[model samples]
Target: MAVLDIKNLNVAYKSRNEKVFAVDNVSLSISEGDSVGIVGESGSGKSTLAMAILRLLSENDTEITGEIDFKGKDLLKMDINEFNKIRWKELAVVFQKSMNALSPIHKIGSQLEDIYRVHEPKIAKQKLKEKILSLFKLVNLSDRVYNLYPHELSGGMLQRVSIALSLIHKPPLLILDEATTALDVVTQGQILSEIQKLEQDIKMTRIMITHDMSVVANSCKKVVVMYAGKIMEVGNVEDVLIKPTHPYTQGLMKSFPTLKGEKKELSGIKGFLPNMSEKNKGCIFAPRCSFVQEVCHKVAPKEFEIKSGHLSACHLHGSEIN
Candidate 1:
């Protein structure tokens, strides 16, 4: 059975009396223990999709629709009280900025205790202490740093703390939204490796959201390529990275330098991301696509199944159905 399933999910923000859609008609299903990566450039709505699933977006200025089924339960329709029951215990998120997540004035141990006490307030002090210490050890942090302030920790340590917090209750589903984007290259690589190991050890279904295609190549088993608030392509890591069907996905891989292949200059895609406030009838990426056709600019393309699990949304693949 699928651990997380989203059907026709749409997320839009109110801006100057206009709605700027961030995620448009995205449907995806992730099975148990699957490491899926949603990759796209900034403003591609990958992060917005993550935030929407977590119910972190403010309902006052945002309009969200469609079902977000988590293990057979629709999270979007869940009441606040009911949602809180599983928010951090069964599902958790490690956001992009780790340095700002912790309070500068408080000790790490105290803050961690507060988080634990929220869900398990009746637990004994001794048990809480054991749990905190165990989480610290699991994240490779020394027990001595437990009492240290946020300012006392390095960037990498702070990120580790963030990860430790997300795993506090051993969540079955974990989402990391650009979790390691702020760290140095070496630190990011180390953390990505650790994340992979954590998946194996804890058997957690994870969603890794990032703008870098390389990150997806390193950490994810399945990859979803997003562009202009829409999913352009999705397939297993090896298939998507090795043979991208969508032009946007191909351009993304072309921009990244490969170590195994012959040396080639990084020729990034032309033009910038389109404005999200305005909805277009045709393909959103049509303006920048090298293979843009007359039909691409006149009508939107439906998702075509290229293989068993591989799908791409492009007019070039439309012939498979029509």
Candidate 2:
């Protein structure tokens, strides 16, 4: 069974100017031990989708709908207490910036111990320390550093510590929301390697949200491509990255350098995203799609199965429509 299943998810933010659909109707599933990467440009609803899955968004002006089933529990309808219990135990999230995520006033060890106490209040103090040390080693960090404050640690070390803290309860599902975007290329590579090793050791299900195609290419087995708050394509990492069928996917691929010997120009997709408040008459991506036709602007496209386990939401890919 899939560990995380999202169906017909929609998120909207209301404002005087317009109501923006940050995340449109979208569905995807992640199996146990599966590494799925959600990739898109900035403002493409990648982070919004992640936040919605965690039920962490502000509810004052935003409305969220759809079912998020994690381990047979409907997260959307769960009470705050139930959601609190599920968080950091069944599912944990690693935020984008470690510095901002961790507390500056508290010692790293104290902060981690607090998390452990919250999740497993009955755990003995000595055992908690041992567990924290063990986790530090799992991420290849020194136990002595636990006494240091968040400011004392380098960006890379802070990230590793953050990862360790997030895994204090050994969550079955771990979401990395651009966890390594702040680090240098070499450090990012190291962190990615460590995460891959940890995943193999712990059998953790991972949802990696990143704009970096290289990270997705190296780490994820499956890829979810999003554009303008809607899913454009989904398939095996190799298939979507190397043999992209949708114009948006192709454009993203062209934006990144290829490993193959062929030299290709890195051209970005033209046109800005549609105003979320404006009621779309047709496909959200039609205005920016390279092969858009009259029909594309009149009717929203439905998902078409191109191959087993590979799907695309573009009219051009449909045999009957094209």
Native-to-model Cα distance after best TM-score fit, residue 227 in candidate 2, in Å: 0.5
**Residue pairs in collision within model 2:** none
**Which candidate leads in lDDT?**
1
- What is the per-residue lDDT of model 2 for residues 146-190, given as tens digits with 9 covering 90 to 100? 898988988878888887888888788989999878777876787
Model 1 C-alpha lDDT versus the unseen true structure:
0.88
Best by TM-score: 2
TM-score of 2: 0.94
> Could you estimate the TM-score for every candidate?
0.94, 0.94
User: Candidate 2: where is the Cα deviation over 4 Å?
Assistant: 318-322
lDDT string for model 1 (218-301, tens) is 889999999978999999999888888889988988898888868988989999999888898999999999889999988999
Tell me the number of clashing residue pairs for each predicted model.
0, 0
RMSD of each predicted structure: 2.5, 2.2
